[model samples]
Target chain A: MPMWEESSLVRVVPSARPRKLAKVPFVELADGRLQGVVSSGSDISRVYVSSVAAGDFAFACRTNNNRPCGGLRGGFCNHVTALVGEAVLQYGGARVARYLQAETAEAADAAGTAAVPTAQQLTAAMSAVRPQQSADGQAVTGQVFSRFLRHLAYLELPATTAPLPEMHWFPTAGAVA
Target chain B: MRADLLAAELPDLDEALAAVDAFDEVLAGGLLRPQPAQAAGLNALADAVAGSPIAALVAEAAEKAAAGVAGEEHLVALAAGRTALFGAVHDAVLARVDEATGRPREAAPPFEPGAPLPVNLLASARAWLCDVARAGWRGMDHELAATAAPVVSALLPSAELRRLAVLLDGFAAELAASCPGRTLEQIPLRRWADLWARGMLLTQPGAIAAAGAAAESAAGAASTALTGRLLPLGVDLHEHATGVQAQVHAVFEPADGGPARLVRASVSAPKPDTVVGAGAWQLLRPHLSLLAAAGEGRAMELTGMPVTDEGDLLWSDDRAHVGESADVFTTARVALPAVRSGATAPLDRHPTRIAEPVLVEGYTVDGSGAEVAFVIGGERLAVDTGRVPAASPLTPQAVAGSRACVGLLRWDAGRFRLQPLAVQSAAKSKAAVAQAGAWAGGTSDKNAAKAEKAATDAVTVLRERAGRLLRS
Candidate 1:
């Protein structure tokens, strides 16, 4: 399927519920990772996905069954899945692929060496990302196709709320924040 | 050769003459060189062929390289050799300890019927007095002392009596007689000495003096009951809206038989204003971790409650129960089978059982209470920082990944945690990286902000220089 054909992440989040994913403030950082924040009860969640790093993850949430009310707990959840899905819909799969590539390039540079991606490779990847053809051998598009994935990844009622820490958790070791 | 000789560079002519004399002896008669086959020296040209200024500079450079550059490498090699040596030592110690102690006990054992918990208030007080008494008491194990030193250096939990009582409840009874009023309070040590020297501490001096014969007879009959023995304590602690409560069982033998002591105690949370609070992630975080590591039932001789300045039970930063002294709570940090977050290696059953501690390096906090980053097996890994007491003085700044501490690494759920039973030493913050760098290492919030900016600036400069060098 084409990059545009990649379904939106809104459907995956269980908390995205009745109204579905709230479609405002979808942010893509300088590094190409995307995030969509949502509020379930008093618990504000950052549904984040990185093409390069650990992709499709939840930061702080009110309801991760195994862990306390914050952090990247409960590895696989609707909120994290939803963010990645939404990003796919907004930026297209091509953009995600590009982000991942760029991140890899940066990492390579940091480690003292990096290979430049060839134009032919880029074009080949771009071509392969297209949607499959219809019955008439034409690209499939402009149809009322819908996507539905049943998931109970979010809260049902009174959202899980625990106190947030005074400071945020960031990996700041050698360099300052 | 003539020009080089004329430029011979010693400030003193006497040194030059001495050099010439030595060269003449070597060339003419082999006086300096005992072997006749040695290369002949030019004695007549010795004075004229004095070494050049270049020779002096070359000699100086050679000396500098040996003392400065080569010496540094030598020191590094020495340290590496020492590290390998110590690793072997560590392995040897564990091997011996494991062989002697028949290792590998179930961490979270299956439920068994046993005795109820007792709230031994004197245990905590006397444990505190153990510190007071440690100064004079001769029974301390100095070898074992090194093991518990890492974590204790930063965070020694609790200042109030209630906290101590909750942890080591069995102490006050032993320590009470030493106090002036014979109460479980922090009293002067002088009074304890006065009472102890008279041998009035056990039972009563008056009774012993007056009824010597009767006392001896009674003591002989009651020796079995009075003899000091360690009773296995199995306690289950839970946190609820009301407060923390513990179901303690003092198990002796025979599973079906009744316990030696049965007791019930209600534990209240700490005062809200003091650091931890109810409903706060900080409070729930450590509990979740401990529960994962040891599960419910805990077996240890000592237990402590997290108490406030006023001795209120603290559940979180803002929530706690108002309680009087002698309240029971379970927040004691267990020494064995330590938990390390994000570890890949299988936990050695033998390592945790050893009472003696190995040296642990300082660590940086990952904030979520799960991840504590440190270098182990030569790689920097973030592991779970297991079960730290609320009152323990651990700080993010001090325990940063950049610094080093001494402790053991424990693993749970595939994560390694730094179980710093005792702290060894911490690095000198920015002074470690650079002395003149404009980084302010402070404990305050403002200083934290400044340090960050300085770090960024430092990185930017470094990157720019790197880019320039790379391009060149």
Candidate 2:
């Protein structure tokens, strides 16, 4: 039990949800990238694994089998956009912006009130950066999908208020958000 | 050598927290079950810190737990001590950490602090009258006279604020005829005296440091903008002899990260009879949408908002724009601060706690209604329902069933109590989070159906009253 500092409330400008999370699940900020599995619109059985690197905004989107998404034309595909939106939901806009180092100078209004980038702006900013697809798309896809499957395992536990031994590291104090 | 010994002998902060966490595991399961290991850990910690400030109290509690006294009273006392000890230790650890990090502590203000008073004196007079009446007019007259007489006498000569002082005296005199007793602490006498002092202080410019500075700087500071997730908790309606006031209780999450601020918007009306508990929301509906986003929190973009030093947001309707409504349970569970357990002695003496109070979450209610204690972070904090508004849906039954709650945490009646303003039964439930009562003014979808009839009845009565007043 390390003595935590006198905790201060963290202020957040909650990101606007421009897209529903059903399109993208298993979104995470990990391994220096925003990566997740996204559902294919036309084919329910098909799924796309997408990722966008933090800096330089380099991105890659491919089917779990490493087939390049038809929508990827040197810029973000729909799957990448959905990944960013879901990431905003999981980790707030301020955090996502900080992670990606996204430009916020243009976010200010005429009166100069500070505003957080909308999902559309953040996605568009990612698009402006010259698209650099990762070479190991299949390996990244396998990693994220396995993580998603691992999360689903949590639902199996019988519900109880008692603290689980495995989840003890989770901060018991005020929420960081 | 003694200094070295004392430093080495000090109780370890991490061990204390770990011990409390372990104790919470046992207490949450019900105190009747024995856990020898947990008791031994506490007893060892107590033994380890013999001369520390809390050693005796901790040792006493550990003794009771080790004895396996299965009595309800023993359990209750253990629960109280557990909550108090956690807070005290947590604060002490933070203070030590701050010292180690060389963080500058807040400098104490030079002047003796006075009770914070609202700007409006007329409302204060009416509220004081209400409190006196509610307390069966007991021994309040002498206390009222003793507090008010000097303030009124001081202000009588000032022609500008004389009427306000006179109004305060009238309320005091009205109660002096009956209700005689020697008990000074029966009602919130300090609250009554706060308004009196406020009136007297207003007559002299710059008498009170914070209030005076706020008044002088308000013009230049009005244009500051704040953008954040605004969670409207519930509405608190104050009914006095002269009128009714509905204060929309809300918290503002800043765009960056630091501390959340308590933002409040108030609407007052002269018609006290027509505007009651749940009905007051109707009057405020036109000015603020905070009520609409009560249980389910909202993201807000605002410009030109004013804030007090105490972190109270001054509501300016025209300057604010409401954005998306967030998941109520997630917002309540993650965004709100955790309740810190400790002796509320510092808070008890003050007329008003100057620190901005953001609502607390992650608490499960134990006990029923006003008698309830919030079991949170492994400690049980009791609820003092005396100040909770009648329109709030946080009833006795509501307390028991709620899985999560969002409410203002206050120090009252010798302990910290969570006055739940909003409650969520389950995550992603259709209603999301339901407001504790009818105070939302049909804003919360959960209570919208219930508040509809009450608001409608209030409106019809208002229309009839207007017709008669105009005709006469």
Per-candidate RMSD, Å:
30.5, 28.2
lDDT of 1 by residue, A112-156 (tens): 543434323332333334312122211111010000000010001
Against the correct fold, how does model 1 do in TM-score? 0.22
Each candidate's DockQ:
0.03, 0.01
- Model 2 residue B389 lDDT score: 47
Candidate 1 per-residue lDDT, tens place, B171-193, comes to 22123212222222232222223
Model 2: CA > 4 A from native: A1-177, B1-229, B233-237, B241-243, B248-262, B337-364, B368-370, B376-378, B385-388, B426-432, B437-439, B443-472
- For model 1, the superposed segments whose C-alpha errors exceed 4 Å read A1-124, A127-130, A133-153, A157-177, B1-408, B412-472
lDDT score, candidate 1, position B152: 19
Put down candidate 2 lDDT per residue, A3-109, tens digits, no spaces: 11111111111212212344664566655577887877887556788988777777888875668889987788888998887777655666687667676545634
Can you write out model 2's per-residue Cα lDDT over B1-472, one digit (the tens) per residue?
0111112223655565444444443432222334676576546545544555656665776676566553333333343344344445535543432332232333222444433434444344433433332232233434553344444444333333433444454334333322233332232222232222333323233222332334335537643445555655565544332233455556567666545645555544332222344554555555555555553356566555555433345455665777787554555455544322112222112312212223444666677544667665666655433334444555555555666665554332122344555666644554445555344545444664465565565455334333332233
Instruction: Indicate the residue-level lDDT of A23 in model 2.
Output: 62
